[model samples]
Target chain A: MGQKLTPGDSRSNLYNPQLGMTLIVKTVTRWVKGFIFLFGVYIVLYGHLTPGGGFAGGVIIAGAFILLTLAFGKEAALERMSKTVASEFDSLGALMFLMLAWLGLYFGGPFFVNFIQRNLPGKRFHLFSAGNIPLCNIAIGIKVGTSLFMVFIILSVLRVVVKKGERRMVQMKRRGE
Target chain B: MVTLLTVLLFFMVVGAIIAVETKDLLSSIICVGAVGFGVSIAFLFLRAPDIAITQVVVEVLVLVILIRATISRDVTAISGDREFFSMTVSIALLLVIFIFGLEVFKSFPQFREPVFTTMSDASTNTYIQRGLIQTGAANLVTSIILDYRAYDTLGEATVLFTAILGALAILRAKARKRTTDSSEGNSDQ
Candidate 1:
């Protein structure tokens, strides 16, 4: 979402106001990111009755993280979180998704099969009543959020390290000792 | 159908402009991200969510690679390349693509077609129609990815794995060269 400030960045019109006033920036960005993220969640949750599903929701959730990165710098975005933690979250998401598929084996008759027993008393077309569809959405949300967070951290870190290395190489070449 | 495709083409043009004219490298990559999403939306409109998802995944990976490349690359506008002929060429290409799309849409059978019209009649009908029955999985796309086309899902996993590997190779290339240089320095000493 956001690019690292470069030597040429001074030429660009945008500024990193988030860095100076993070308290205000964080609040606003959180709302913006949260809205986008939740809307994706809603789409995935009700995908059975309408359009959208796990992958779409997952990407949208991840896009929210990209927004966070753009609004706040990488460190600020992960100030309370860490890379390994995000990776763990990603694994947990993948695991739970697998577990849901196995549930089909016990009740739905086979792997990846949806077995709706029609126990819901609510009328059709309502949220929370999409049988197993909402569950898939939840799984997708978790997997996407965590994995995307991990990707954000990794890419940001690489950018930082690469810039540092480039500076060092120049310094070494300058010193002819 | 023409309206849908026209809207999609509009998105493509905006995305191309963003990706090309944006001076900021990261934003440019993110512009590509925007293009990817738009392309997937177009795919969805075409009734191919499977391709859409796959396209999304691949494009995301491409964006990551682009971001990595931008760390060493610079973007500049091709001011000199902006000529009447080039503009004509681009517009002509876009018009051709639009015509081809419209032609394909025209070839599709009307909704009256019995077999292809209903979701239950499709090839993956076995897995897709399970949503109304017992499996409990609601999102047919999820069901397709995780169940019916599980093998394709595995292939997607492999694609991601390959992407991760490619990223590793790219990001580490400089470091590897640095390590080798340091080793050479040690021998020189």
Candidate 2:
């Protein structure tokens, strides 16, 4: 829906037809998105040591992306994160999480066992001391973030067309139709 | 503390009622979010920070989804007769549930101390004591979820994966159907 302007279109650079909000809003979003993303990463990494974990962090990460989309329009946002890339990351995250769980089985323990060394000398509450928990959190964070973002993107692309006074919701064309 | 909890609960209930009764979809969604925030605060006050964090994030995600879903649609109010009937049924159901809940609450013994203290098994005590030593994590909730009950966490993750996959599949199918229909129309034309 947002792919109307060609690269060589004169208006492409001058007026971003894909521009979502006012200049002030976009400027605020540009400043905030990075910090929000970093906070999400921090939450995921420190999940074992802190209250926030994969799901919460992932949602926050998705929130940052959503904010970007809201501020910069779908085309600009998709340049940063396309649907295919998001879908692939979602699958990759889920697979990585599953593989970690299977690793426990491969090591002759039950499924999802904390196989890595948990008790390292003088490493208590340290970031790297969680024995696969951090890895799991990262995987879950990626999966949840991408999935939620995908959901938002997909839903936003559904255009409600009122043709001849009959309302219909249709998936917007990849290129403007 | 009790007064604080009571106030939060009152607000939560009011928010929930507003969410259900509101004609505007966006306002209803926001009201629901307010209720969720109140619940999260209650969870924190009850010493369940992990749950509170998850609840708040989930609430926000849900709010975003709801907003996106309704953004382009016309805000059509429910018909008066249907709305009145639904409201009547809902209020009646709520009254019945409240009465039953009060009866149940009365049946339970009064707690002189904390509810966890009254328990005979002391599972909470055991988890608190052994959680750090066994799991090597400072957060008890993390230790329980990722270390002690890792399998349960795995199952929950799998459930989440399945749900997302299902949603993606459905949405993709709809898109495919639309494309094929348009293509057929073009060929006919």
Question: Which candidate has the highest DockQ of all?
Answer: 2
> In model 1 chain A, where is the ten-residue run with the lowest total lDDT?
A11-20
A1-177 per-residue lDDT for model 2 (tens digits): 345556554334324634577778877887898999999999888998988888788888998898888777766667778999998998898889889889888877888777774324236788877678788888889998998888888777754333322222232232225
Question: Which runs in model 2 stand beyond 4 Å of their true positions?
Answer: A1-3, A7-18, A118-122, A160-177, B81-94, B107-116, B120-122, B180-189
What value does the lDDT take at residue A4 in candidate 2?
A: 55
Give the lowest summed-lDDT range of ten residues in model 2 chain B. B73-82
Q: Give lDDT tens digits, candidate 2, residues B1-189.
A: 888899999999999989988887778889999999999999999888888988887887788788777765554444233467887999899999999999998867674465557786767777787777666678877777766777787787678778877877777777777666866744553
Badly placed stretches (over 4 Å) of model 1 are A1-27, A115-123, A160-177, B1-121, B124-162, B165-189
**DockQ of all candidate complexes:** 0.15, 0.40
In order, what are the TM-scores of chain A for the candidates?
A: 0.66, 0.83
**Per-residue lDDT of candidate 1, residues A6-107 (tens digit):** 555442312455252356776787668769878777766766555666666777777666666655666555644566677676667666767776876887
Q: What share of the true interface contacts does each candidate keep?
A: 0.16, 0.53
Per-candidate clashes come to 11, 0
Model 1 Cα shift for residue A55 (angstroms): 1.7
